[model samples]
Target: MPTLHELPGLAGQRLGPTQWREMTQERVNAFADVTEDHNYIHVDPERAKASPFGRTIAHGYLGVALLAPISQQLLAVEDATGVNYGMDRLRFPAPLPVGERFRGTAEVAEVTEIKGGMQVKVTLEIEVDGQERPALVADCLFRYYA
Candidate 1:
């Protein structure tokens, strides 16, 4: 956990990469069940192969699902509770084909002290293996307080 003070200032910024496990069929199916985004490109493996992407693509929301886990590792937020305020700009430049690995990098774009809390905006870029473009990119805001 990261101390609250450690976060008041720009904690750190860099291009970080993670080698993810392959996006499995089971996982995609599970996400579909939970979100009700049963897009054929994400579940119909046989049919997906005939599409341009050549494989069932993972849901765009799955990329968002990784935010908390990755952010926890990236920021030290031990003493304070942070709220996921929301997103600003969001874009998915590439498809996340099933069985592919991807990772995210974040840059702290804005930080401010408001009331008794701190508001931070982090720009995130998610990329998949073998893809030159990013799968997801956005300005995600979070607020931490006493």
Candidate 2:
């Protein structure tokens, strides 16, 4: 974690290609149950095997939702609390096939002072193991307050 005073200087710094995590079928199913998005492409391997992807894939939003935990591994401000502000932009460039390993990498794009806090824009990418393209890319904003 960086101190509040040091935060401003972190712009353009690259954070981790975090430890790899698998996108399991059970996790996909759980997300499907919670979001009520049981699209066969996400939850049904047999059916999805017939689709172009040739196997079940994770819902795009599931990767979006994973950003929270993934970001934790990349950033935190010392002696301050942070909250998600929003995303400036988001794109799923490639599907995250189920059972594949993925990890996050982040670059601190910009940091600015806010009225009672600081705001940072971090460009985050989730990459799938063995895939050339990333599963998701986002310019995510966050606010930190002491």
Candidate 3:
């Protein structure tokens, strides 16, 4: 974890590979219920088998939603107010198959001084276990107020 004082100088630093987290069917179903996005490819295993993936997969947004928590393991700045500014680009190039484990890696692309703090641009990557391609990639902006 980097300290608040260290944030500015930490630009271009590579943080993560956080501990792997398994994607379980229960979590996928819960996400589906919350978002009301019970797509067959995401929630119905039997039906998905007939589709290309051969099994149910997780929603892309679920991978995005996990970024903050996953990045927490990579970076922590206390005594600061942080807000998710947004993402410049996001992609789910590969499927996140159910029951597979995934992890995230973060890189501080840029950090610039703002009115009361700094705006950090982070490139976050979520990789599935035993897979060559990342499940998700996002270029995110975060404003941290000191």
Candidate 4:
């Protein structure tokens, strides 16, 4: 948990390279099913091998969806009511092939006082283990009410 004053002071601070998580085929398939994004490269293992990636890859949006759970492993906000204000930008620089491990790190990009809360922009990166490029990069915003 972070104190009210602590959040403001955290601006420009770097958080963590969180525990790595595997991008399993099953998880990728489930995400594809739920989102109805049945792209062959993401859900069809055998067919994906013929694609440029040479293996089934996770959907770019799936990485975005996992940010909430992954961020929990990096930090917790137990003291305040936090609302997701949505993302500022998102990019997938590399493919996340199934069975690969990835982790996220966050830097507090900016913090501003709002009407009844504070809006914080966190520059987040989800990098695949052993890869130079990150699977996802996003500027996510959150509003925390004191």
| lDDT leader | 2
Expressed as tens digits, the lDDT of each residue in 1-146 for candidate 3 is 55666798888889878888899989999999999999999999999999899999999999989988976667677767788899999999999999999999999999988989888999999999999999999999988888
Off by over 4 Å in 3: none
> What TM-score does each of the candidates earn?
0.89, 0.98, 0.96, 0.95
Residue pairs in clash, model 2: none
Which window of ten consecutive residues has the lowest lDDT sum in model 2?
72-81
Ranked candidates (lDDT, high to low): 2, 3, 4, 1
Worst 10 residues of 1 by lDDT: 11-20
Question: What lDDT would each prediction earn against the true structure?
Answer: 0.79, 0.94, 0.89, 0.86
lDDT of 3 at 19: 88
lDDT of 1 by residue, 31-129 (tens): 999999887899999988888888899898887887766665565477788878899988888988888887777888877887777888888877788
Clashing pairs in 4: none
Query: What is the alpha-carbon lDDT for the whole of candidate 2?
Result: 0.94
What's model 1's overall lDDT? Answer: 0.79
Better of 2 and 3 by TM-score: 2
The residue-by-residue lDDT of candidate 2 on 35-141, one tens digit each, is 99999999999999999999999999999899998888889777888899999999999999999999999999999999888999999999999999999999999
